[model samples]
Target: MARIIHALSEIAQDYDALFCDLWGCVHDGVRALPEAVAALQDYRANGGSVVLVTNAPRQRASVQRQIEELGVPADAWDSIATSGDAARAALFTGAVGRKVWFVGQPHDEVFFEPMKLIEDPVAIERVALDEAEGIVCCGPFDPHAHPDEMRPQLEAAKARGLPLLCANPDVVVDRGESREWCAGALADLYEHMGGRSLYFGKPHAPIYDLARRRLTALEKDIPDARILCVGDGIATDVKGALGEDLDSIFIAGGLAAAETKTEKDPDPDALHAYLQREKIAPTYAMGKLR
Candidate 1:
């Protein structure tokens, strides 16, 4: 059974570094959570290094700007490692072709800059999968809704046996009071249609490996057991930590809050059952990061 705690302070001293999640644990999409921000600040003030490991489909600099815009303090984290960075690096070294069909929002265009790849806009709109050598999915074109509109394109890509590169492996993220689909959801749909996908984010080894490198740069000799991952998403954050053999702190009041909370408090039984269903056991469970 996981220990239920009210604040991250309870376990802060037990770890030397934190591999923290960005979206849910640190802030909602609209703004930073004051308590969460304070907790992170406090943790850093106590000499612990923090690496914001996010599945955001943009580079670390872009994500840092977004976090600043969302009111997160600059000193709250030591460094950042994003899935987009990992994906770009992988694509740069991989055997994938240069011509690609990009699927995602306008902001995601930043991912293509380093690759010097040509994007077929017409192919993306017309489902002309054969026109491109590969497909890069940063996220859903419209994250607020279902990805049903992408079915035709996915089917077409599958028929052509095109390889897909998914930057973010998060299926859904909490956006203020709502939830939205992410790139992982679209990649899952594509796989369901028998298309092959290469993922670069959480629940995958690449992102974790990138985060560890960043952490090591910040603080030398911080072992995996000394690093704790704190996040709300069971499949991404918690599962990713387990995959990397690191300890985790599950935030019950973030993405899973709706189903795991009773009134304003985290329902221990509900949270436990949910974790059991997901087949993950976090080292600690807390209502909020603070």
Candidate 2:
């Protein structure tokens, strides 16, 4: 197994573009990770493309606003993409006027409310999957609740041939205080049952393609070899980069490690195990971007 490094300031100088993860690498929900933010700022100062891709359930614009509010340096990235933006586009391009059902936490309304949606899901009594045209899912019914809690909905949506649009493509998240499942898990289940799903965020080709297009617009031609993805989660961050055939730098102190009870620090063994399971390894692994 490859060893994880505690600091990686040297590697920053070699990359032309930095594809970063936002929630875990740059912030811990409430406050920004100063080191990670600074690393990005420093990288950008040296003329590197910094693109922050998040699996957040909100649009890219909303995420930018949030980043500004969190004190993340405004110029940290050259572009941004979110699962929400992709999900919305997927819906708009799909069959229109399709009655939709949303299953997510309370805050997820921001992602769907702008669409002039048919109904607010929280108000519905006994959500009837058979009666709906589609489902706009932002998260699991309970982040921590087991998959069985979602089985009924997934089975019903699949049986009805309802398209599931997952705004937050993340299957799990470090909720600042604890680990909880996100919308991605339910969407996966629905897909497993033969239901089609549209994912909007990181690790997905559309999102990466959007970021690559922005990078090209910034410069003449950006080589994939020069682009590097930095993220915390194995599924979204590492796997996302792998799918795109881009090098990734894993952050152990980010969202994927949020459930730890001890003081936050990078764990090498855990990272190696994660990499082994994936059958692919990141170019580097560090505690934080700083």
Candidate 3:
């Protein structure tokens, strides 16, 4: 609990490349943070390569389209890597031919576009279970009006002893001005009921490996010594960076800001303690990316 904030520009000198996080770090869901967006612009202008890594369960192309709509410069980064792409890859190689019962939003079905989609509703149709070789949990739901909304469905999947594939395993996300439960909630509940979930997104090696591949495809060797990762969530952003052996700068102004009092500097003491609880040790910590 040091309660220390590092100057962004000052640390910019130490890293040649930066892996930035979306959602909480750059935007609160509705609009993009002017300062955070500016920071990436500044970093890139300084000849540093930036790769925007996100746990969004959509393809990189779709995420990029959304980002461009948010006023973020498309040229700000050298590349973009998304969890959806990784999930699709898993469906092709790792879980090939597995009959998947996806429990998520209709748009998220794009992630399972590669899989042989079984559209029968898991909640209403019992026969869907008979056809399912595995379960792909995407989002909990748009508005989680009730916990049992997905509980019965999750319970059913668990009882069937079907392996779960969580495309976007983020428990929660800052959607506009509110925090809503994501796909991870269902995945967690399934696992609690003795079900296994293979996460294909952030905080996992497959996602990072995909991002690394994108970086290498640029035809320029990344100077590993000068690379850095900036993100919000400890489970995905920070943890993903650590898993990839990259120095990470945790931006606590997003989802974790709720655990603090002030939005500007958020209680560093409490944040440090929270990180410790999550077993995450970032190289640098900041209240916001800017």
Candidate 4:
């Protein structure tokens, strides 16, 4: 069973670096979590390095700006690595088709910038599914639309046997006090419909490998055992850490808070049952990252 702690201070000395999740662990969709920010600051103040690892569909610069706007202190982390960064790298390898059907928010158009640098650039065309060679999905084309409403397009793409490149693999994230669907949810649907979807984020090695590289660049010769991943999503964060052989700290008050906690404290029995059901074992479980 994972130890339940109130603050990261209790185990801060155990790790040399932290690959912290930005969305639910550091802040909700709307604002920064003061205690979470303080925990990172405290960790860094003690000579450990912190790298903000996110599955955000936007690039690092865009994510940095959003975090700053949300009041995340610049000193809280030493570097940032995103799934978008890894996805761009994968896109450059020329395995995916040149002409792609882009599906995501308009702001996520930033993902296509790197394609312009390649000799034979991948052209992003928002065309009918039949006209496209491949599909690149970042997130919901319409965040307010339900999954059922988005199925017809996915069905059409599936019929064409187009490969989907998913930038962010999170199914749902906590936005303030509410939960919202993400690209992973759509990807799940696509797969259920016999469509192939390629994920570039957590629970997959690409993003974790990128985060480790960023952390190593900041702190020379850091080993995987010395790095601790902290996040709220079990499938993404905890499973990702396990995949990379790194220890993980599960934040119960974030995405899984509704099922894992009673009031503000973790309900031990419920938390245990949930973790057991999910078949994941985090090194530690805390009410919050604080």
Candidate 5:
């Protein structure tokens, strides 16, 4: 039962800042969405702060570089709070133990890099799964493959009682037109197989706390009522906003494109039905960020 708006500006003035999702809202993984970029730029121009709250399983600096290469300029956002940073904080504190099994692409190696955030940090080591104390899953080794393919490894880990630290809780993402699996899929399978999986991203408290810190660093103490969450993931983004008791804008054009019948805009009836089925009630709904 959310109001459908044509542009973010329609409600921009109501919020002092935005907790924006990066992947599907600002860019499609391969490139920037020009209209979405313009909308964010306009919001910032009017003195509203923007914190890019992403579930990307990489540090903010690495994510900043990746977005810039994808055509997202520096002006569109003020700061970034990544799932990797939140998860990294937990890892360094030994949430999953010191010697853990690493599961992710080579690019995600930067996640293990040293950080000054922790005064007394655990010295982490990457060891073989059988020899390790816990598992750190940044993402699937192959995104295109089904989650079931990870059964053998997850099964062994379950019997061994190893805890899994899920960096990014997204099940899938569309890199351009091709959709691929993410770390969350493996975590989901692991939990189903009776293994314990820890989450730090959207719909969870850790990442939101990180995003608030990022926003506070900008000298803006935005109240919950004055902050808006923008994203495409119904489960992660909208659900997280609800959990945090913040107003949210659901970008239907991203993950729920088909379910909401979103072309230029989501079909009102279809969008309503989709939300009804999901049992999530965002503050507002729009086809895209623009």
Candidate 6:
């Protein structure tokens, strides 16, 4: 069972650091949540470190730029660990073969940029699906369209035995009241349709490893017991924390607001039912990040 809390300050002293999710917890896609930002700033001021662990399918630098534009200040976090960086390393090492087909928006083309870290990297080429050996997905070409629309392409890739490298494992994200489909929806469909798909983000081990590396780079050797994972995602954030054997604080006000009946706090009965359905138990639950 998950204990519902009113604010992060109630247990802030117990953790030395936080692995916080960005999209729905800290920000709502359009701008930073002021209360959430204040809570993080106060935590850092009191000597606690914050690592913004995100499943955004873009480079850390790119995420930084986007968050800055969306009103997230620099003082709120100590470091960043993005799904893009982890996936990029795998992509460069030939996780998806040389000639591949890409399925994403124009902005996601940066995924093909040269990597300086991988030694003797594979020479990747973005070619047509007919000429490609694998598929790389950052997101859907049209985020608003239904996932079923991608069936034709996925079937073709399955017949050719092409594996999909999913940059983000989130099925959907609420971008300021407008929900949008993500790359994971397509990858899930592909796997369901008998094609292979690879994931490096939340609920997967690779991104957690990348987050620990980010923590080490900052000289913070905080133990597992002293670290807390905070996010709104039940499957991605909370599940990832459980898989890593870390305590988690689920923000019910983010993605599961309706299911949990959250406004200022979650309705206990509703939250209990929702958690029971998902079969995931976080250490704590809050209406919002604050």
List the candidates' TM-scores in order: 0.93, 0.84, 0.88, 0.95, 0.99, 0.99
> Model 1: per-residue lDDT, tens digit, 141-214?
89987987889888888887888999998999878888889999999999888989999899899988888889
Q: Report clash pairs, candidate 4.
A: 7-290
Model 3 residue runs over 4 Å out of place are 1-3, 94-96, 114-127, 146-148
Candidate 4 Cα outliers beyond 4 Å, as residue runs = 115-126
In angstroms, give how far residue 50 of model 4 lies from its true place: 0.6
Tell me the tens digit of each residue's lDDT in model 4 across 1-290.
88888788989898999999999889998999898999999999999999898999877888999999999999999999898878877766654576778889888989877644357654445566678888888888876677677788888888888898889999998788677888888889899989999988998998888888887777556888889999998999999999999999998887888799635668999899989999999999998888
State each candidate's clash count. 1, 2, 1, 1, 0, 0
Identify the runs in model 5 with alpha carbons over 4 angstroms from their true place: none
lDDT of 4 at 288: 81
Error of 6 at 230 (Å): 0.8
Query: How big is the positional error of residue 52 in model 3, measured in Å on the Cα after superposition?
Result: 0.8
Off by over 4 Å in 2: 1-3, 95-97, 113-128, 255-270
Error at 42, model 4, angstroms: 0.6
| Order of the predicted models by lDDT, top scorer first | 5, 6, 4, 1, 3, 2
Candidate 1 vs candidate 3: the TM-score winner is: 1
What C-alpha lDDT do the candidate models reach, one value each? 0.84, 0.73, 0.74, 0.85, 0.95, 0.95
TM-score of predicted model 4?
A: 0.95
Q: Candidate 6 on 1-290: residue-level lDDT in tens? A: 89999988999999999999999999999999999999999999999999999999888889999999999999999999999889999999999899999999999988888879899999999999999989999999999999999999899999999999999999999999999999999999999999999999998999999999999999999999999999999999999999999999999999999999999999999999999999999999999998
**Per-residue lDDT for 190-272 in model 5, tens only?**
99889999999998999999999998899988899999999999999999999999999999999999999999999999999
Extract clashing residue pairs from model 1.
7-290
